[model samples]
Target: MPSISHKIQPCLWFDSQAEQAARYYTGIFPGSSISSVSLYTEAGQEIHGRPPGSVMVVAFELAGCRFTALNGGPIFKFTEAVSLIINCDNQDEIDYYWHHLGEGGDPAAQQCGWLKDKYGLSWQIVPAVISDMMRDTESGKAQRVMTALLRMRKIDFAELQRAYRG
Candidate 1:
């Protein structure tokens, strides 16, 4: 309905799954949408190797952040160095995102709420309170939370709460 006002937008590189990834992400987050799409023309066919009228880039938004999914012919891949973080208010939210985002993902790559999704995108599903606890270093809550967090893949919210209290 309105224009994307964000100055900086993340452009994800996909081989040929740009549209698929855009749809998958839009379906998961509320108030998200695929705002626009651009098709490749024959002008750059020799270099890009994509056919005319094929999907080239899909612009979308998640959590109010605009993103561009580019069918860049597998030139780049997602790594753990950078990830999208999803902050949840509670355990159910964590579980909900963890299940959905981690589907068909690399199980071994999952650690401390960080997961690599089916599309090779990395995501961090964490509870909001964990950050607060992790920053409460004066009370030793940060240490306890870090200890508990390091042992978890999908974060245990209740366990973190217990750690925070101790």
Candidate 2:
């Protein structure tokens, strides 16, 4: 019997900039690269009537997760309802992603460990200790932390920690 791999790959739909986006992602993340790029062609013109040399699909990896970007011609657009969440160990990790993803991304306030990037993609830049902080049984403490988060565009971990203690 042969063993099957259970890796789940996410496919991203883009208008015409799939390759550029893939390159940007590869540059931002370590241990990432373009796995493959495919083009579309039509049978009558060339199979499905797609123009030759048009980008069909791009397979890439970021932080070891596989994602495919399809140049689907803008039929669908991304929304903030679904986003990639990053759990940061410290302020430095948070800052790096915040600067890059938020540079052109819109900022939305979510109670604890959530933000929306410009591409309408959601991201959660959460400190590793957030779970421990939220574990506090005291409702008041949790409320205070939530309050602090509501006031932030890019979350400040130190401030959240202070709120957690108060």
How far out, in Å, is residue 111 in model 2?
Answer: 8.3
Q: How far out, in Å, is residue 128 in model 1?
A: 1.3
Total backbone collisions, model 1:
0
Residue lDDT tens for model 2, 1-166: 4232536778888888888888877887778999889898764453344578788899888887888898877578887667787778888888897777666666443435566654555677878777777677666777787788878767799999899989
Q: What is the TM-score of each candidate against the true structure?
A: 0.95, 0.82
What's model 2's overall lDDT?
A: 0.76
What would the per-residue lDDT of candidate 1 be over residues 1-166, giving only the tens digit for each residue? 7666887889999999999999999999989999899999999689999999999999998988999999999779999999999999999999999999999989999999999999989999999876688888998999999999999999999999999999
| Clashing residue pairs found in predicted model 2 | 42-46, 42-47, 42-49, 43-47, 105-118
Runs in model 2 deviating more than 4 A are 1-6, 43-50, 107-118
Give, for candidate 2, the lowest lDDT window spanning 10 residues: 41-50
What TM-score should be assigned to candidate 1?
Answer: 0.95
